[model samples]
Target: MRLLHLGNVMMDLVLTVPALPERGGDVVATGSRSAPGGGFNVMAAAARQGLPVTYAGAHGSGPFGDRARAALREEGIDVLLAPRPERDTGFVVCLVDAEGERTFVTSPGAEATLRPTDLAQLRPEREDLVYLSGYGLLYEANRAALTAWVPQLDPAVTLIVDPGPLVRDIPADALQLLMARADWWSCNAREAALHTKIDDPAAAAGALRSRLKRGSALVRTGPDGCLLHHDGTLDVIPGFAVRPVDLNGAGDAHTGVFMAALAHGLAPAAAARRANAAAAMAVTVAGPATAPGADALDAFLRQSRPAPR
Candidate 1:
């Protein structure tokens, strides 16, 4: 199965600090590295699952963009990038504290410059699943482009929407429209709460499931695992235990594996389980796109104890 991931490709500079410093105080970074971010990480996770995946995004003519492309290629993802001559590649500076919590400062950079016309250049064949992230919709240009293209999708093609950190400010009407068009909606607990104004994660997932025309709603609850609501049923999948060195890209890894499992024809519950396992493995590493290989992931799944009833 082929999956197409549409969103930003960023150069992530991750710094592991001993702890979060006080306001205006200095903190020494223990370690630092650069890796892929956003949709790039998702595509990497999917590719690591041995799926045929392609990434669509904007890249600049710079070293960072070159590094991003190389990183995707290393994961076996086909890169379909629109070139931005004037701007540099997008980047995120992530600061991870001792507890694995993170803070991010991002510049949309070249990704923000992508236009609707750029999407028209590529053709998504039938049976290709499309995966989109909320970060793409955070900007007006990409939002308008995605909004225009979503309605034109063929019913046979599945579309998965991951409302990452940026969906809170999206206009309600626009959010509703995108949800209506999506075949699957995935969000973390915080994002679901912010978007639906429902404090409880389960209730927020239910609200999202109810509001969408069709498709399942998945609420990712960090270490608690994920809650899925679809077709008047709810399934809760427990997370696997792992020593997390950095939690920055764990959610993106989960979303990516979820899409890959769906493309591989797994049921929603089974897909969530696979995704949770992948996420558990992701947090054990440090880089933003540090997903496990197929062999490692399979071993991890094999050894994982089942979730308690």
Candidate 2:
């Protein structure tokens, strides 16, 4: 199965501290690392899971772009970067605390310059799955292109949508339109609540499931676990307890693993379980794109005895 990930590919500079600092307070960072970001994290994780993955995005002609592409290549992800000579690659500065919570300061850079015409360059086969992140739809140009391209996609191609942390900024109608077109919808508890206007993650996920055209709704509830609504049933999957070093891209890892498992013919519940294990492993590392391979992930799953729903 070939997975096509569409969104920003960025260089992420992460600083890990023992604790998060208060407003206007100074703290020393204990660790620092650079990795990929946005949908690149997901694509890399999927590739690590042994999925055939292709990435579509814009990377500039700069040192950061070189690092980004190199990181992707190391993970064995096929890159389809837009050729832009004058722009610099996008990047973000992320601060992570001991508890794995993070704060991001971003510069869109070349990613912001992606135009509608770029969408025409993507030519995935009918069997490929397209995974789109919310950040891509946040910008007017990319959003317009996505809006125009979604309906034209081959019906055999599965579309998975992750609203990520930016769904609150999207118009309700646009959100609905994307939901209607998606084959699967995944979001964290906060994003799910914001999208459905429900404070409870499970209720919000259930509500969103009803609103979807032909897909299930999954809400990731941090350490408490995750809840999924599919085919008129709700399954509560427990999250594993791990000493997290960084939580920056855990969600992205989860989403990627879930999509990869699905592409490999796993049931939705089994895929969610696999993804949950992958995410548990991700938080144990320091970088945003630190996803475990299939062997490591399988061992983690074997040790994690998830609670029965």
Candidate 3:
């Protein structure tokens, strides 16, 4: 089964600062780098697990777009849409403080627009895993196109939704439409709280999972790990503790690895286990695209296993 990503991929300008400055204050960054971020992190994480991935999102024509396109190609992910002319891809200015937390300021570009014809070009096969992000719903064009197209998907195809940080901003009707067809829902603590109005991650997972017709819900709880609700059972998958260098893309890493593992036939609980490991590993690194490959993930899991009694 292939993984199809119908989300936005954009450029990320990351600046490492000692701490985020207060409003009207100034602070110089200690380091900086630019790379493909946003949905790119999820796709890249899945690709590293040997998943055959396709990016069916809009790209732009300028340097940022060019770089994002190149990065996708280099990662062996197929880009289905040609770059939109005269427009650059959108970008996020990521400010990372000493605690590994990041705040983003985004500028939407070509990636924000989606036409009806763009949706027509997608043809998901049986058992194919299709991913949609809350970011996609932030734009009227993309939101309309995706929500209208979702309910029409074949039963054989699986839909995964990750209602991101902007979950609260998405229209209720659109959010309901997407969730109605979602077969898997993966999100973090804040996002879960926003969607379910439950402050506890495990309880939030249970509430969300109850709404699914035939699917599961995963609520990632940072250092405490994740809660997976599947087949009427809720399992708390413990996290791997580590000193986080940067928390950017950690949730995406968990989502991508979880989907990839599920597509490869692992049980929901097992998939959550691997996803937890992937998230832990991602935060230990300092970059946004730090998802581990299969070999690295395997080795990390092996070493993290408990010793024999």
Candidate 4:
């Protein structure tokens, strides 16, 4: 099965700073780098693992858009849409703190301008693994189009939704409808807490699953690995421990890798274990989306023992 990533290509300016600046204050970056980020990270993570991925979002014409498109080409990901001239490609200023945590300020660009017609060309197919980002679904320019098209997807398609950090910002009706149709849901601990209002990851997963008629809940809990809930049981998938230098796209990396594994018939618990290993490898590098390739990832897993049954 092929993975179809529905989102925008973005340029992430990752900066390592001792501390984030407050109002009327400034903190110089200790280190900085520009790379592919945002939803692009997710697609790259999957593609790096040799997953066939098609980007179903709009690319734009500008410095940011040019590089974004070029990066995808470099990663062997297919661009399924034409570039938009009206809006530029999106960019993010990601401030990674000493603890490897990141804060982002983003500008939604061409990614947000995806009209309903743009999605029509890439209709959902049976056995297709579709990735949907809440960041894109909530944008005003994309919301109506996405909402109108969500129910049209084939029931056989596996739709995974990651609400990102703005889970609370999406309208209740829209969020509910998407969750009902989504076959799987993945998000970080903070995002899970925000939407479910449950502090415990297991509880949060349970609450999140209550909305979906068919799907499992996967919550990435940083070094603690991820919590996977399916059929009323929660399993904690342990991850590797490495002192991270940057944590810009950790969740995206996990989502991509996990999707790749799932598309290949791996169970949720097993897929999450591999994803955890992939994400841990990503944070060890300066780039957020620098997950290991298929061979490298397999090697990493071989070095580690199998997830406990």
Candidate 5:
């Protein structure tokens, strides 16, 4: 089954700085680069693992949009929607600190202007995986369109929802709706706490899993890997050790590889194990699309020892 991502994929303007500047202060970046970010990371990660993927998001007719489309094509992902010639694609200004932590500021453009007509063109088949993100839900136009369309998806279709860093900012009703419909709800430790009000990752995962209708819950614990709760059992899928140079797309790598593994018929825990490896590999690189390809991932997994359970 193909993976259908209905999330926003925009340009990323990444700045490498020693530290974040103080209020009303400025800091010069040591280095910088631009790339297709946001949902592009996940799609790239999945495609690298041999998943046939499609991007059904808003793109614009400008430099950023051109780069995004080109990047997707380079990764072998299908672009399902045409560019909305009215405005340019949006971009995120990412500041990566010495400790590999990142902070972001967004200037949304065409990606925020999703319409009902765009949503109508999507046609997901049974067993096809559909992905949604909290970033999309944060925009009014995208939120309105997606909330109206998601519930109507075929029940046989698998829904993967990533609450993202802006999880707390999403409206409560919309959050509930997406969570209820998700076949796989993947989020990081902080997002799990925000969504469930439980500080412990395992406890938060348990609470999240209880809300799913017929799906599983995953709480990614950064370098410690992730907790996968399915079939009434919680499994701790361990992570590999690495000196992280950039942590921007680590979660996206984890989620992408996890979904790809599932698409390849791996069990939840087994899929998470591979995802853990992908995330570990992502952070060791210095960009937003650092996920490893299938052969590279296999090589990494073969060389690394599993973490003690």
Candidate 6:
């Protein structure tokens, strides 16, 4: 089944500062650069794995939008949305501290213009997976649209949801419905804690699993690794030890590779394992959209995780 990515496209400007600035307290950025940040990061993860990927997110006609479009085309992703000239592409300024934690300030653009009308042309198959980003669920404009569209999807079609940082902001009704329909959910520990009201990572994962009914859930714990609960089975997918330079897109990388593995017919446990490795690789790089193809991931995994004595 092909994977369809649904979410925002962003030009994220990452500034490496000594620490996140306090109000009225300025700190000079030691380094900075713009790179693909949000939904496109997920698409990049799938595309790098040579999966058949489609981008249904909004693409604008602004400079950053142009770069986003070209980058998608460069990766051979089928762009499902045309460049909207009325609005510029969205951007986020991310401040990375010495410990690689990040703080973001955002401005909406064309990506936020995603209306329910935007999805009128989509035709999903049961074998295909429609991946939803949490921002789309939280954004008022897209939320109502998705509330109407999700129920209409053929029961045969699979759903993958990543309830990102805005999980707490998602309306209760919307979150309830999506959880009922979602086959897979990916998020970091904090998001899970907020959404599930469970402080423990493992407990949060279990709570989500219980809520999902027919679906599965994954909770990522940086350095500690990831937890996956699939089809009544649960496992702790180990992570690699790496000096993280940037935490951006790490969850997206996990989601993208996890879905890609499932699309390629790998079992849930195997898919989660691959995703863990992929996410471990993401933080090692500086850019938000950095993802390795199958070959590179395989090499890294084999070398970093040698057979036990």
| TM-scores for every candidate against the unseen true structure | 0.92, 0.90, 0.94, 0.93, 0.95, 0.93
Off by over 4 Å in 5: 18-26, 98-101
Candidate 4 global Cα RMSD = 2.1
Query: What lDDT would candidate 6 get against the real structure?
Result: 0.84
Please estimate how well model 4 matches the true structure, expressed as its whole-model Cα lDDT: 0.85
Top TM-score hit: 5
- lDDT, model 4, position 239: 78
What's the CA error at residue 40 for candidate 5, in Å?
0.5
Query: Model 6, 112-204: lDDT tens per residue?
Result: 777677788788888998999888776677788788898998988889888888888888899999999998888899999998889999999
Q: Point out the worst 10-residue segment of candidate 4 by lDDT.
A: 300-309
Those runs of model 3 whose alpha carbons end farther than 4 Å from true positions after fitting are: 18-27, 98-101, 306-309
lDDT of 1 by residue, 1-309 (tens): 688887888888888899988999999999988777767888888888888998776788788888887887787788776568787888999888887788989987887766778788767787788988888888788888888888888888888988876787776677888888888999999999988899899999999999889888999999879999977998889998888886767888898888888888899999999899888899999666777877998899988864554
Better of 1 and 3 by lDDT: 3
* Candidate 3 lDDT over residue span 202-273, tens digit each: 899999998777778989888778888888888888888778887777998999999999999998889988
Error of 6 at 264 (Å): 0.3
lDDT of 4 at 17: 99
Candidate 3 whole-model C-alpha lDDT, 0 to 1: 0.90
In terms of lDDT, the best-performing candidate is 5
* Cα-based lDDT for every prediction: 0.84, 0.83, 0.90, 0.85, 0.92, 0.84
* Per-residue alpha-carbon lDDT of candidate 5 for residues 99-160, written as tens digits (9 for 90 to 100): 87879899998999988899899989997899999999999999999999998999989999
How does model 5 fare in lDDT?
0.92
Looking at candidate 2, what is the lDDT of residue 223?
64
